[model samples]
Target chain A: MACSCVAAHLFHGGDFGMSVVIQQIVTGLSIGGVYALLAVGYALIYSVFDFSNFAFGCVMMVSAFVAYYSILAGCSVAMGIALAIAVGILFSVFIELIAYRPLRKKNTSRLFLMITGIGIDMAVTNTAVNLLGANYRPFPNVSVTEPIMMGNIAVGKIDIIALIVSLVALGILWVFLEKTKPGLAIRASAYDTSTAGIMGINVNQVSIIVFVISGVVAAIAGIFFGMKYAIYPSMGTVSTKAFIASVIGGLGNLEGAVIGGIILGLLETFVSGYISSTYRDLFSYGLLILVLLFMPGGLLAKSKSDKL
Target chain B: MKRKLLALLLAAAMVLSLAACGSKEGSDLPGITAGKTIKIGFVGFLSGQDAYLGQGAKMALEDYIEELNAKGGILGKKVELIAYDIGMDPNTETANACNRLIQQDKVVAIIGPESTEQAMVAIPIVTEGKVPMVVTTASNPLVTVAEDGTLNKYMYRMCFTDPYQGTALANFAYNDLGLRNTAFLGDVTNIYCEGIQNCYRDEFTKIGGSIATEEGMMASDVDFRAQLTTIAESGADSILLATGSYKVVSFVAKQMRQLGLDLTLLGVDGWYANELLDLAGPELEGSFMTNMVSDDDPIFADYIEKFTAKHPGTTPNVYAYYALDAMMSIEWAINQAGVANSTEIMNKLETMKDVPVFTDKLTIEPDTHNPHNKTVSIIQITDSQFKTYKLYTPEDK
Candidate 1:
């Protein structure tokens, strides 16, 4: 009878429990979707080039600045978004040709690439600082202020929009990677560049295509992030947190990135609401460490292997 | 081998250039006379996460130095400011920076250590070095005052200490605005917030005002919905925001609007951002804040014109004024001392009274080295600007 009573108490106020659960789920999905986008970029570049690009954060920051400067120059919100994406594409291409291409020819070690990547990151960030004064500036608002009511829970319009757009972009990317001929060539290059080259696949062209897509994903994330939070010259540091999300989700798994991001987001919100907000990040990272201890291959690793 | 030789020559040239700069130092050196070149060092958070404050302080310093140079410098010396970026981790770097300036650079004085945390670390170093240092930011009284209630001889400050500023805000809310019941939202991570909260709490309760809710938030928190909801439901007459610009604006405006709270908002100098007005929109229109100076004051106007004429691009922030006041105060102390020695300047600085500037008519108490009889401005935000409602000098209340 006591056990039954406790269960009843836990499940009491059906509407409240349902709404709270829904709110947590929605918040997790929205933020996780953002993490998924960033992880996809990180994973794609790593898989193809076997290189860690430290300048990824700077790429995002520069894209956000492009959007900021565009809006400040009397452009509409749509124009700002377009400018960010365009700049991201251009920057990615530039970085690939200037920084990565020569190293690729030399078949540089992963460590060497990582060091060069850090140097590039510093150069880019410092250049941005020199050009734009170090101050926080707000992004032009494109989000509708109204919160869409879903039962007892409410979600902002931007949250819903970001989730939808992220899912759509991810879907398009998945199709491009699976259904197209270039997709197979890219995968072939990832597994064995020599094999791909012998099979008449232009590996260099595939690498450029991969970078372009990664840049677009990062730029979209950057634009959406700036819309939510204010932009600063060092705002790239925020991406470092997302990188943590990426690592927790599993380093090379795209789907794991999504799962990890959502789980981390939900963990943060629930902990912040119930426990101390100061310990929210602590809880998330602690959970990540615990999960790694138990599941060394990550939660979504099984799914990726099964599909492969 | 020729390429290697070229690289060697280039490196040697760079070292040679640096050595030339190194030799041309110290005011009393044969080639460097006191009236020919004045060297002052600025140590602040010039790089790292909190670089924004440093940027503002640097802008002000640049403007003030230009103005001084144009006006034939201090006693005909061309004032040259050598700045060092101490970063945010002041405990580790501030002392080293101060030592480098005093021992190696041989600057006549130093102008900053922008944050209170940085100042605390730097004060002891400057005092021990016997070099005069003027802190350009706020720290509590305990920083300068010894346990025996004597001021550190080499330390001085241009900004009002947090206790006075905090109490001034509370006094403004209770007496000037006639709001009695208040709620306090303190940032636990910041010493500034904690100091101000304590002062306001004590002063408000003493003045017959009740604090309905007292809650805390971390400095980095952007959301204050839960706290604001509690404040709104508590039936408080006003809410005291005691955080920096980013969190203060977003949390107050968004949460207040969300909860439909009609309480008057009051803040300290932390709310002095044009972006805050933009972000907060109509929510900040009738808000009151206690500040040290307002941009529209005639004293500030003359300074602004002079600053603008000299430094054409950078807009003068409040920190610039404080930085200017800091350097100028040191120049004045040195002029009064009529000597280059640290002890002579320290002696003159301790007994400084009625030092007039664009910001205030400051008089330093001999015992505390703190500005006595200073003026505080009560500003109201209307149409996204600070309109000075009242200028309360020390004698006023």
Candidate 2:
């Protein structure tokens, strides 16, 4: 139905017609895949902690820099990815331990936690700026710059790889959450942190686990973003979309995060492709408002009227 | 009674010192005595994200000053630069800097606060303070003229206004390059981009070139694939990139190629950065852009060599050249006026003609307060480097 809606716009006199629509969809899916990785990470933390992690974008930035410098130091792309993941996990865990754990122990309000996240984000961004100057550093050894031509439509190899990897990662996470014992503990903590602790689930360990997962996800997304765009200090600003995606998906629901991300990406591309690129953001934010007003629980969110 | 007397004496001493400190900085107006050093005020971003731009302008101004002093100074008095860092926020810091330059430093003239926002802020202060300021590289039309078309007589700009560059691009694309149909892509959020884009549209349409589509994106956007795809199908042979960031230009160029949109890319001065080459070298191989001055031009050869010698490991960018031009304008005004008085210099600047600067022999139009008859160099990316395509001057309509 969405494809048809886009196709209808093309009949108004585009040369390439349906091919342009196909290309836009491919690009949208790729960006959406990256957004999903970030949204799910945000949702994971929110489910347990009940606060937005504004610093999530900064962690992605750190990972991108790690990956960028690693490549510059003559490491292979695979090696760079591995190093980024390690650094991302370390940085996220450290932020949690230093900034969040103590606050959580004090039983501070969620607003305080959100403020701390903002502070951390600003500090990280400033430090990165001072350390590495604000020049755009393009990712090296991204071998798939060429697009594969399927008939008349062009498909980026990186986009295909990104989409497949994101789906696979999300699938594995789903299996882990549904079938594994530790995953059950995480779910329990998501339901009620104090009750989970009382039931001997070790909520602090779950927090660590959640952050580690977030790190891994951020590392992958950051690398892809760096490849698609260039690595810069403020590349984490793109995480604004992920935050919006999580909101549209229902803040703490992983499945909803995926759906919301894809929806946002597809709608953004459609707006840009058919209508006007300037309206793309306006449309996305408009959809966000409409979703909040009408379906606050989000598209795939479970019935939680009290939570809303 | 003795302690009270001591306190009163201390207060008197502090007031006397304050009065002395005020005198040391001299009068709150731009002027020069026969043997007194001429104070030139400079305000720009010194520390923050835009520090590099400010530093470039500062260094260029300082280098020019050093050269002037070595050559027996302007009007036989040493030219002293009183520079203040505006930091980042133009709204608050620019006013303070302009005020300090006018009231405290008592500079003969002021230069810079390079961005349009800071330049506009300096206008009211400079006018009230009765000081003349030559802003370096604030290209907006409203920098010198208000929205109501009232001129800010005290303010002048070193670079060509935004409309001039846009018209030049449109003329070059239509008459020179023979491009009949084109598409426009610009950052809607940036005034610089929008200004040029609007002018280009107006001129391009007036010249009989058909615009297939016009698109807008945010300055912060890193992705241009969706936009490029739409542009590809727009049936245009070329596209105009009115974005202010080299990063965005490179992204668009690369994505355009990735999607197999093989159209000619035309850009503004924003695409002239070195990093643009690194980001999308092959993609932008045949693309064209408009710039202030061509490096290959003999006019800037001496200035470039001297500037490079003065500042090692760095060649001067457009900001440096614009700063040099601003300094030259000030020197010319002082020579023409036969004094360093602000009102006299401003009067000289208004009717300034045939003043030779590093880029061109400049003539500031009294009405617009922008340099007239300035050449816009057309640059093309050839073999991963900027090559001088042409030195174009848009014919007066």
Candidate 3:
């Protein structure tokens, strides 16, 4: 009732209301889309490796720097983005070989891998600090300021572009995973690594591909993050929220990640509109803990084992 | 066997004599460098989140030390500077660096740990060691004072505390801009923010201004729409933000624009950065901030010229100037004491008054151990750059 009253005050007086709410929601969705992509990358890696890739965020940070420096070096925006993706792929492979492969050979447990992941994260994050120095660097603005009008609601170019890109990327990923041979191999590897290896599928190679894909997605998220907010050494900390989203969405389920991301976005927008904006993260985590206690299996979870 | 024994005895005698010669060389410079060199160790954030501050401090120290050495060193002996990186985890690294410097490096005096957290941690260490220390950028008044009304004899700061900067902003807003009603958005976690907020409240209320609303946000928060909405509805003519992180400041600016709030914004020295302009875009145009150091100051211009001429390719920053001035103050104390002893330096530092530096006429009051008669400047964001409006001194209205 209080929220409605405020809404009425804003609407009737032409002060602020539906348009502001819509604007907030669009902004949240764009941000959440970036988070979702980042969460998907973490989920894809975790599902296969049974360990959270902490360096994933640093990988994103480093890719952002690469993109920034490339643009400064006289490359076009598109070329800079491509270079960033390439760097991400290479860096992910290097990290897997140097930091993960040795531990994998020892048949490290999930806990051990998790500890190693933290070490990698610290080392990589600090290395960025050493090379780039600790200062916020602004990305070159793309100047896509034209707002698109969908009926009475107006959306900025960034929001529309983000939504379209995220949806397209997810669609391609779904098609590839469900309808392609490599996707089937990846699924088989996820189901049982040894059996997939015995079935003439190179499980190690598939894992590498998954890591590379995750790196690419993370890099895309980082570029958008830099565009939206300024890039800095500690920017990786912001991704932890997205990781929470993945767990809430059902850690291994791609659909769950997407649903979790959208729900988180909408909830934040609504709460900022009604309750308060400062408590948005608090409400998100509170709802997540609540969902975990009751449902256990996320809102769209399917696997019986996942319910546990 | 007899020949071999004779040769071994001769070799031992030669080694001992060479060691004696090395010791003699070390002890030759008496008075200023009696027994050993005067080691001035520097501990600051050299790596991790805020490494830029450390880098700036390091460059400034290098330039100042070079200048001092070129002028025949401090007290007629070459000054030795040993620096340690505290990263940005001040609680752990500051203490560790202090112990390493005092216990192991045997430094006579120390400089820095540039941030408030690190400086606070270094206070006890230096006091216990009875070593005089000049903190590089700790702007909190608590750094040089204790809870029991005792001044920290060995601890000193060269930067103007946040309270003074806050009062400067209040004066600018009320007296210059003619703003009477204000709102506040402050970070609850940061001592720097809290200090500035308190000073702003005290000074603003003292000037017949009314605070319309006061809101708190965490430093890590990236959104300020709700807070901005409340301020917009509070009918305040202006808002004051006391926050350290540039990201949150820019977010507040953006949210203000989105809500169509036309209130003028004023901030403390924490808002001094080009990154704020880039992040806030045109939304920050006409917003004002109080700066203890500005590029337009003639003293700063000379320092920049000398620094750039030496370093080449490195841009001069306010942090660098503060660090250089801090070291210069230490040198002045050493000169006034006329000895390199810690007790003498501490005693002389307490008596210092009206010592001219590049930016202002700074003096340390023995009672409070806080600087007096410091200069502050009012600056506004114009065309994505900081432009100086007027300089404020303690004598001026």
Candidate 4:
């Protein structure tokens, strides 16, 4: 009886109108934009190395912490963001040099490389749990609190900023990858590292550059997330969604990663808005399963021979 | 010859360590006080995110034991404490801690475990072990009472139940805040959240208040914009966050502000932690929460003074208050029976009435083994500091 009463009130009194729909769409796009940042970086690394850098999540977490303490230590917000990116780049490169490079030098199997990435992720997350006490540290109000109302629809300034920043960053990355000589070298390495090396492309240089790019995007994603929510050690778990998004896109395709993230975000918001929030994760994972079963190579699947 | 010598040394060392452990485990009969000390075991999370509760409880127990030993130990035997960290895993870790405390430590009684999940895991073990436990702040009714309405004979709790807290908050919301419609934002994965959410929903609806939306999330979820966006559209004047996870609470608060939905936030004892302030100070300003104790409560003045002196630069959270009460209540029961026996202690506790604790007077109801007629405090955040707004006693159901 009580459930029905609540349901009746929700349907009749509550406004499920056009403005609400617009708000949900804006929220979805903002979240999708952040997911796209992480997914693109993840895809970039996978495209070059043929392994998922699961430790990318920990890099994001550490960068957020750096940003938090830096700002607390009297640095301006801009400085804080810059410091976060710098730390992210440094940590990612450090992990590669110490952990991955040693294993790669041994001519280790790809499975071993993936496992090492997972090991690094666990080690870093646990170390963070011990060093930084498990507490949520919220970012100071960096974005304007006032909502921009366009007719009936209300949008926060942070959401708009997130969208614009994601687009510009991804656009710059697209141009760099398509037009630059180094980008060509990196792409050639992704296609065939041995062939790229034989043709005078610096394979080792490509590896470091890819990691550097991954770190930049991870830092940007981490900052946006920390600003949106509070930052804790396990906040890196957001990368799980990014991982799922990247998988839903073809694993090695940059464009597919972006589309997959946007699609995931839109579906999550629409489900939560119309149906129930409980089923939102269920739908996302279910979609992943469906994609895997029907289209194992993902929505933008390359030919089997090309992937091999 | 060298290999033989190394093997022999390893064997001898292992045997000696085994002997040391054997001696440490006092006697075969549990709680008989074989040696000069009466052992008391404490099981709580000393690591991970919820470590604050367990560590605080451990400190309070250690302090109480020190004071008790100085005043001449229970029944003239020096009191000994053996504490274990249950950590985050409830099923296995809590079970191991309770088992080791009862079997190996041979403790006369036990105190511990703050969350309802841990308490539930510990209940069956403690009951089977016949080692009475005074649980601190595990507020689910089932912690002490079963679903079949039978009392868990070996278990007792220091804080008020989730239903009581929910009812109190609902009454406060309807009567004081005068809000008619509200939304529920909670972590379904948490029993504490679910318990309070169910009760608050039933009681709030019973009193003619309508819920606009009820959104569920796991504790692992960080992004709540999707849910918040829905709540904003639902025309709800406020949101009831049923989770005690200050992490989730602070996240929801900050995200709500970012979404431009300045809905009044309602919370439970979970919001009593100081970390919430550090995380979402500005966002939580003017929000209301229900708790059993606050830092400035006069009744805890003596305890607070001693605690602050013991651990400087840290104010006692609600866990510290309840832990002190749990220790004192166990002390009272043991003193009334005049022995360090679990059965006698449980019997004495069942009929206890008007026994004073650090926070307030406690009375154990025989049927449920829960504190009866405990006062729940309504706390309002004023400029990021928690000020006690009102003291409410829920009507007996």
Candidate 5:
């Protein structure tokens, strides 16, 4: 089998060279970058609330469909994206208020809250299935499908764009958390909501802000993913990967989720590139197990507890 | 009054228990009640992953029933089709629907559950009830055979089975394209995909083409970069995607090209849909897939026109055509046999030949009850439109 590949590449004149390896990594990173964008928000919610906002995935799906229809209704690509983001924010805050806020007020158990989140995820995604049908709704062309070749390595336009957007989003988030007053209030609340409230931050306002930010980021991820792949009701369930990334990043660490997502993506690509695509999932989830056993706090997570 | 109420409750309980045991108390499955109409049952996934399959079949059935009734039905009895949607959900609802169509609908015959998995589960129930069921798109051989490989007397398939199409695809790849090395990527969990994979492996290897790699994919997985990257490295000139889904294939095609693998893609009739072209976009321009007939084939222009008029801007996929043929074949069988009994109609179908179907001439093999000598149109997607490339027929060898 290996000999056949070597012979084919040799005969074809590429020789399975370094260029191909770089190309695979670049492509994998783009995919991983999208996962990080999603998982970071997932981690942030988990960090502040101490419960998985599983409904966040469904919110992203809702945004994806909104963007798809916006494109179909003759909206420009930029407007479609903007519409998706606005709708995403709406759903995010809505779910937060309806599904989480009451539970928070009542001081529900984390398990109960997580279960409610799962219930919301199912209800919304399934409702979409009922209303929209499970057929694949192809997102209209937003970018050229051509690859931009830089010397030896060929890069997809979507790939380069997704990677750049993800980095910028993450950079903006980092700066907001480190440099601004609201960002400081958000961080302070995440540390201790009661203490932050006592120190003059409105905890309810902080929660809304966090949800809106998550919605904005998730909406971007949803739009890009819908373009690259087809959009359907169940596309939101792809958040299973984000959930895994969040856990691998020690449950609530932002920077750790990003690293975990990229690492998982690279590992999957490398495994499929070198060993076998069949084992890609095995190695990826296997790495998850390995990480849990050795470094449960993740590469960047300071402790097993909360950090935003 | 209390004693009377207790006696009434006891009587109702006994009656309900009896009904549960009978399970056939419904009025729908009345057998040949000498009505002024002949009834047949249709079941398909009108919702979920295979929704369009059922939706297309529904469109075909509705149009066909209207056309048949206008022509005074099969042998002068107005044809009444009792249709049901299985919703393509993850449950035994398909089996339940099959049972209802068999025990409740009480039609002379049953038409379809376009999904192979649904058909596999439902066929046994239909067979046990001794109703003749001619499936449309579910082509796995097990559909027409028992596990021990005996021919099922009642189960019939209107479309060519997987083994034939699978062999034809391999032959096309090796002989027509002159490709020596090919790889197989499919869902091992899928009964339909696995059948095609196994058949492709045997036929391609028999034709002297080596399989560079064989990989597995889950239907739920959206990412194929890893599996595709592996296939790319294997240096195969083409990839035979045995999966029976548009979304999975579309993602793989785009990702395959993105990785710069650029291998030719081949698939079965499952790739026949306008949605596939939209989802795959430019990446699938040169890819090939076997179809019963291309939508643009002049032979189907009339059918397309009628369907589009009925559906308003929707091009009928291969499943719709197959369902139309299924209904037509059942009507022909009833006409040839000149009776409404399922046994006689099924016997007539066992030896059906040269029936004018939507695709072309179709003949059912007497021994296996599968379509014989059916034409397989090799279709190419050029500029995102389906164009006929060539035709090939499969042999058992």
Candidate 6:
């Protein structure tokens, strides 16, 4: 049904014919797959902490740089990817310990935690600018750049790689959350941190687990982002889409984040394909407002009227 | 919490004040006590990505000022430079820089605040201060002229506009390279990108060529496969990037090549940087760039030597050359007018033409204030060197 809606909106007046729309949707799904990876990371953090990690994009940036310099240091792309994820997990854990933990210890208001995240984001971004000298650098040639031709439609190698990796990561994440004991602890924390602690669910351990997962996934997202585009200090700014996607899918809901991300990506590509490339953001943001006004809980969010 | 907020605010204020200090290193400025110093204020970006340009500009202006002073100065008064560094794209920083130049420094003329974005912020203050300023190397057309297309009285550009950049690309792609089916990718919110894209498109279509695909990237976008895949299906023979950032363009170019498409990569002035070789690497070897100034000019051989000597190991781009030219151009006007007054200098500049600078013969086109009769050179990266491909004038009057 969503595919049909995309086709209807993507074709500008049945005059251009029934072609090229499938190509746009496939490409969009790939792009959306990367966005979903980043969005789910954001959603996972938000679910447990109940505050946005504005610094989430910066963690991805650190991953990209780690992967970039690792490759330059004679490591293979796959090794760099692994090293980046490992580094991302460590860095995310460190940030949670230093920046977020202090606020939690103080029993601070949500505003202060959000502000601290912004400060962390700014600090990380500035440090990168100072260290990297603000030049955009690309990751070493890694992913297969050639596109696989499937009849009339074409699929890029990087897009396919991104989609497959993101799907696998999300699947693993789903299974972990649903079937594992630690996942149950995380879920308890997500319900209520105070209550979770009272129920002997070590909230601190759960926080570490959440950070590690989010950070590892973001590492993939960042490296893929650098592979797709070039890595620069300001690449974090582009991750604004992930935050928006999370919001669209209903913040704090991992499944909703993936759905929202894919939806946003499809709508963006359709607008660019059909209406005008310039109006793509205008349409996407407009849709975001409509969703917020009409369905505030998001598309697949669980019933939590009090939360809304 | 209140105390913490106060400390943070105080820290921020201290940093800002330090940036605004603009450091009075060279203002020993002969003739200051004699009331005969021709004070000219300058603003160059000493921070951020384009900081190298600022450092070069500052070096060039200081060198030029010393040379003029050694030669008994402009119209017998020693040229004193009051310089400031615009840290980044902070509006408050721009406002403060402009305010310091006009109000605090009391300079007779002003030079710079690079890029059209900062220049735009500096415009109203310079206009209100009635201090004629020569902005360096920013190609956006609206910097010299108003959004309504009327010329601003106080601001002047030291480089060619985007329309000229567009003309160079179209003529080179059509007449020289024989590419008719071209695709364009640009960021919509960027004035420089949008302006050049529109100009290139108009000129390309006007000359019987058709655009294969037009794709837009948001300022924060990193993925171009969606657009690249779409363009591949459209069968564009070449791709022209109107995105202002070299990194963004290089990424797009790399992706285009990697997508198994054999397409010619074309670029605007934004692509001409020393760091481009590293960013784009072999992917951009055969790529062509339309630039305002070609490096092959024999006239600037001496200037180039001096600039490289001053800032050893830094290869100067068109921006550095323009900064050198801007300083010299202002000095020429001061000499021609026989006074350091702003009004007289502006009038002298208005009627001034045929003045040879670092680039070529330059003129402030009667009312538009654009550099007239300037040649836009088409160059390509051959074996990592910017080899000259072709040259054509955007306007000839």
Give fnat of each prediction, in order.
0.01, 0.45, 0.14, 0.48, 0.37, 0.37
- Ranking, DockQ, top scorer first: 5, 2, 4, 3, 6, 1
Give the Å shift of residue B394 in candidate 3: 3.2
Worst 10 residues of 2 chain B by lDDT: B26-35
Using DockQ as the yardstick, the better of models 2 and 5 is 5
DockQ for each candidate? 0.08, 0.35, 0.23, 0.34, 0.39, 0.21
DockQ of 2: 0.35
Q: What is the interface RMSD of each candidate, in Å?
A: 11.1, 6.9, 7.1, 7.3, 5.5, 8.4
Between candidates 5 and 6, name the one with more favorable lDDT: 5
Q: For residues B15-89, could you state the per-residue lDDT of candidate 6 as single tens digits? A: 987764444323333211113577887787777776766776777777878987999987777888888877666
Q: In CAPRI terms, where does candidate 6 land? A: incorrect
Q: What pairs collide in candidate 5?
A: B29-B104, B29-B106
All-Cα superposition RMSD per candidate:
8.3, 4.5, 6.1, 5.4, 4.6, 8.2
lDDT tens digits by residue: candidate 3, A170-246: 88887887799988888887776677789999877887888788878878877877766567776777678777778
Query: TM-scores of all models?
Result: 0.80, 0.90, 0.84, 0.91, 0.90, 0.85
The sequence of per-residue lDDT tens digits that candidate 1 reaches over residues B326-370 is 866777776886654455666777776778754776677777777
Off by over 4 Å in 3: A1-24, A46-51, A93-108, A141-156, A188-209, A266-285, A304-308, B1-36, B222-236, B250-262, B274-283, B395-397
Docking class of 3: incorrect
Clashing pairs in 1: B60-B320
User: What C-alpha lDDT, on a 0 to 100 scale, does residue A242 get in candidate 2?
Assistant: 93
| Candidate 4 clashes between residue pairs 3 or more apart in a chain or in different chains | none
Q: Model 4: residues >4 Å from true position, as ranges? A: A1-15, A140-146, A303-308, B1-34, B395-397
| Candidate 2 lDDT over residue span B1-397, tens digit each | 9999999999999999888557533234354222277889888877754565677778888888998999988878799998898865666998998888878787878889777767877888999888889998888899999989999989998888889899999999999889988888887767888899889989998999989988878777888888877776777878999866788888887676566566779998867677788888877888999888787777668877877887887777787788778888888888876777777778888887878886668889999889886888899999988889998875665
Residue-wise C-alpha lDDT for candidate 4, range B269-377, written one tens digit per residue: 9877788888877778889999887667786788778788988876567777788887788788878876667777778888889898877888889988888988888
Candidate 4 at residue B327, lDDT?
78
Model 1 spans with C-alpha error above 4 angstroms: A1-30, A46-52, A100-112, A141-154, A184-202, A303-308, B1-39, B45-93, B146-150, B173-187, B204-240, B245-265, B275-283, B335-340, B392-397
Residue B103 lDDT (model 2): 81
